[model samples]
Target: MEKIVSFIANLINTQKQFIKDLKELKNHKDIMVKDDEKLIQQFIKKKAS
Candidate 1:
């Protein structure tokens, strides 16, 4: 009974940490994508000029 409770608590904690990490990763990916788009646009403008 105690062991089961402990196991469940650990699982919940792990899941929470995983969710937090996933959100951070998603945010970083979005920033990178936006930066990439801006870079591409600059490259295109330079090429055009």
Candidate 2:
């Protein structure tokens, strides 16, 4: 019974950590997307000129 409880606790902690890492990864993706958009726009403007 105690082992079962400990296993559940560990599983919950692992899930929480996974969630935290997933959020950070999502934020990083967003930042990269914005940067790419800006670069594309600049390239377009330079090409048009």
Worst 10 residues of 1 by lDDT: 25-34
TM-scores of the candidates are: 0.56, 0.56
Q: Per-residue CA lDDT of candidate 1, range 1-49, in tens? A: 9999999999999889766654554465444544645655544454478
Question: Each model's C-alpha lDDT?
Answer: 0.63, 0.63
Q: Write the per-residue lDDT of candidate 2 for residues 1-49, one digit (tens) a residue.
A: 9999999999999889766654554465443544645645544454478
- Pull out the clashing pairs in model 1: none
Give the clash count for each candidate: 0, 0
Model 1 global lDDT (CA atoms, 0 to 1) = 0.63
Q: TM-score winner among the candidates?
A: 1
lDDT of 2: 0.63
What are the RMSDs of all candidates, in order? 13.5, 13.7
Clashing pairs in 2: none
